[model samples]
Target: MSTKTPFKAIIIGGGPVGLTFAQCFSAAGLDFTLLERRETVTPEEGAGIAISPTTFRIYDQLGLLDAINKIATPIPQKHVMTKDGHRYNSYEFHLRECHGRPMAFVHRHELLTMLHSTLSDDAKSKIQTNKSIASIVSTDHGVEVTCDDGSVISGSIVIGADGVHSKTRRLMNDLSGHEEPVFETTFQGMFGNFPRAANVEEGSQMEPGHDWEVHSDKISSQCFVGRERGWFIIYRPLAPGPTRERKTYTEEDVQAFAKDLIEMDLHLTDKVKFADVFKVVNKAGMTQLQEGAVLKRSFQRIVLAGDACNKITPNVGLGYNNGVVDVVYLTNALKKLVEDAGQTEIRTETIEELFARYQEDRRALSETVDSAARRVIRTVTHSDFVKYVLDRWVNPVLGLDKVYGTKVMGPLLAKQQVLEWLGEKNYLPGKIPWVHRGLVAGEVKA
Candidate 1:
């Protein structure tokens, strides 16, 4: 008779990061279970996600590149302008030329569906929805996670891939006796999507699927017109007061906010105002942009990943991609730990050491991305005179855009994390070379 292995990983939340944990754990030949609070897996937000080469390269390794490529649209150029309708610059960064892949945008729901469908049947069977976590206890031998439904799950570790308002983070805090806030809200935003407008044509100046960014003294807006859908976001800086605290918005608040944005000029096409976009909106949301990085992401056998730990402003589009990198690193570390321990139960002390190393390796990079995102949002919104001058003159006049895109952005993308158990494949080739190649021939990086 064969004895069953005592190592099992429990993943909390079923969003992109959670699903990714499921997939990666499966690929690493690890036993895991995923619990989602929602009844269904599909997200109702219906927003668009920008998939940079930094992310798609990992997707390629996971065998998800072709499916995402089919549904996603390429964003080749970005047009920036002032609120007064003065077109400052249109930089065709040639993202494909720089990184062998152009930035791609896709609806979040479609991406989630594809991610869920691609999982193996055994992996799919392990995902349980409507299972909200009520409590988590880390024992010497393993972890015991109790759900609101009175169900109990025993796992070697708990990975929290939940969102910014993560319950797992709260539970970990309670367990550790710390209650300090993890993120700060700097900007509030309203975003929505609609079917493609009639005026947007394929080859015209108002080309369908064109990316445009308009900036003002205290606010900035982004518009992306796709072949089938159009997305818009207006970000406004909040005053430094107690009211800036994050809170849920009601439908009434959202509608009133929409009214305030109606007269705003978009500079997308001839005399286009936000009202035109609002009239046909299929879905919209008002959100507070929280920005920060947690210094400690894991407590004993419970580890936090993705938005649950690091919250970045969305202007830079690095939040999810960075979270994916966290998953990759954590997955690689856990895979090694499990393999090394063989069929024996992983000790809490050993897990703590592994978690410490994982946090050390990831914290600096996470902070860098966090700082970059904060700066980008501030510069675009002209939060200060220095930021205004940098965005309005210095960057354009000095051609720092190209420098940032190549010199700075290229290296960052090149240094992204990958699954170490899976050997690295040279699918993405450009001028920059990767610093950390995935494990090859069972040879580990020293």
Candidate 2:
């Protein structure tokens, strides 16, 4: 990589993480392109995303925070309730302190539109829709990508931002002769608007908090407020059943799922009927978050980011935030490398050093997130004893002092500093650690 190198980087995906990476690359004066299989940016029916403060910070950095605020609903609280009209645990947070802004809920489509609108004409031109990448070939000089259309594009570096089923990952596996990826579990999710029944409104008006409701019958319902949509999430154990066996759901099945959900909530059962509400069903096939290294170390010019690399459970709502931070750290690291290369000599050795830094910095954080997310998912989806403790003991205690308070991030942020240091050889850009990086870096052991 040289100042006059005119490096061409291809990002294979146009989702939030890929788009954000494109923005950062463009801002850094790099020649980059993004590819997406989807041709349009619009809200998919029945889907919602919870925007955490860390994610808000990334949007703010990209100058889209206000736009997000305009379209999203600020959720200051989460409520947990029981199936039979009893409250379990409630957690409330003031998002301003957690990530220097408030958390919000937005429709998935609206968010895509906001991000897509921010792309420059050059960046937009670089995005090719409906062009799915079929394979990636890394040569001595550059990386060549083959798309479904049989067209080939080559670049100095290739990034696989292509979601969980990444073609780039497959290519890397082929290059390395690794075992086939194994998926551990499948998740089903549905999103739909419920008519604001009087009871629903009353439930919404209750003290602001993250709510979890557990029923004696071994089911749980979690509800969160979105800007214009009220979101209801139900998680049940995946068992062998006719409902679980169906690969795709019919309209009637979706309607029935909604009816059953509403009926399960004693608070809303009498207030609304399945036929009275509008809803949409969204489902994702089982996906594996890749584990272990595909190569001996991070490749010199190739790397994976976001879902392309790891898939954590949505229980923590950190997927988007963590992905955004990946871009942030990668961009800053590359910027530093660029500046250093301009001042001194650049070599393959220097590039390798940077890649090592990336792997060192990101791997542990990724593993930590993976571990924490799985723990939460197991707690929520398995073990009746754990759920009982949460419903019976944790809920009451949380309600008394706002268990999910704005201060929730203090400990998390502190831990993140340690992880970032392990990955980046320094603390996150803005934070000041009690110990110097030089002292801690040695302790981190690369």
Candidate 3:
């Protein structure tokens, strides 16, 4: 009689990180199931994502950049100005000469579509929508995950790729006899894109060389121009309140606010102003960000990835990129653990040791980034005293605009990814060689 290969992994959430995990799992010869709650994945509000050099290299290895590059734009320079329309400075931001990869901007839907398109037919078939997972139980044999339909599935381990509010994370903690403190909604963000103006030609000055960032005593606003549309964001740190709820905005409400934002003299083109762009972008959102992480990420049979593990303020655009890195590291870890079984039974103690190490490696990086994001937002949007220092001392004496955009902070944005450390090579030469730190699968760094 022939024995069956045990179902190895159950992936909760089929967003970018989940799908990427699914694909990586497949490549490692692991059999897994991917569950998504949406009927079909679609863009919630279309906005561009900054493809930092390191992130671009990873996508290139994943067979995604070719497709993404077709629709994405390379941002070369960023222009900084005050709300009063005084030009502060402009710098070569993409730093392609230094990093070997330009800062590329692709809409959220476009990248997700590319990720989905590149998935193998076998991998695509593993994705099941409308199948909501309710709870997870780790058995002596394997993990048993029950769906809202009362249906059950068996797997050796569960990976949570769910978003910031992850059901899988909660269930994993509950099942493993751990309790996590509730996270606070410290800040909120509003962002969306407006259609390109009629005069905004391909490779126009506005398209490639200009990203407008304006600062005032009270607030800061960020905007970037593209061939097709413009992306903008305004971060508002919430004051302490009894109830933690995000401010809601309607399309009409946000559009009206856009007019007020540019009530001063801010113009993309002579003809097309900030006021004009808002009329075109129909989809917009305002959401309270849960900008921190729990102390632990895993408990034996279950582990977390993406926003579920580290939800940061989107001000730095590190939210998804860091999550993607999380997927890569988690994937590498699981591949080794799955291989280690070697036809023997997987023990709870074995998985616990593996997961504990993984948590140690990832949680610190997540927390550091989350705290850094909060600090950046504070410097830009806090009281007039800080703004005075930024405008007078920081921008003029120290050249803060150039400092923040290029010199010191650039390397952190372009650090090497997991695949590179795994020895999966990319064609683009990295600027600063990132030491492997000996972080291969199933090995603890001394």
lDDT of each: 0.80, 0.57, 0.68
Native-to-model Cα distance after best TM-score fit, residue 167 in candidate 2, in Å: 1.6
Query: Which residue runs does candidate 1 get wrong by more than 4 Å?
Result: 1-5, 200-209, 240-244, 268-271, 423-426, 438-446
- Candidate 3: Cα lDDT at 196: 60
lDDT (10s digit) by residue, model 1, range 1-446? 13434688999999988987887888888899999999967777857877888778778778888888887888787878887567787776556787788787887888789889999999999999999999999987788999999999998899998899889999998998876676888788888887775443343424555678887788788887666787778888876632425588778978987766665655443345567667767898888888887777889999999999999888877777888888888888888887777766677888999989988888667877888888888888998998889899888778776777677767877877777656646476766777766667769664
How well does each candidate superpose onto the true structure, as a TM-score? 0.92, 0.77, 0.85
Cα lDDT tens digits for candidate 3, 282-314? 466666667678777888778888888787776
What are the runs in model 3 whose C-alpha is more than 4 Å off? Answer: 1-7, 94-98, 200-205, 239-273, 396-416, 420-425, 437-446
TM-score of 1: 0.92
lDDT of 2 at 61: 50
Please give the distance, in angstroms, between residue 272's alpha carbon in candidate 2 and its true position after superposition: 6.8
249 Cα displacement, candidate 2 (Å): 5.8
Question: Distance (Å) between predicted and true CA of 368, model 2?
Answer: 2.7
In what order do the candidates fall by TM-score, top score first? 1, 3, 2
Q: Residue 444 error for model 1, in Å?
A: 9.5
Decoy 3 TM-score against native:
0.85
Better of 1 and 3 by lDDT: 1
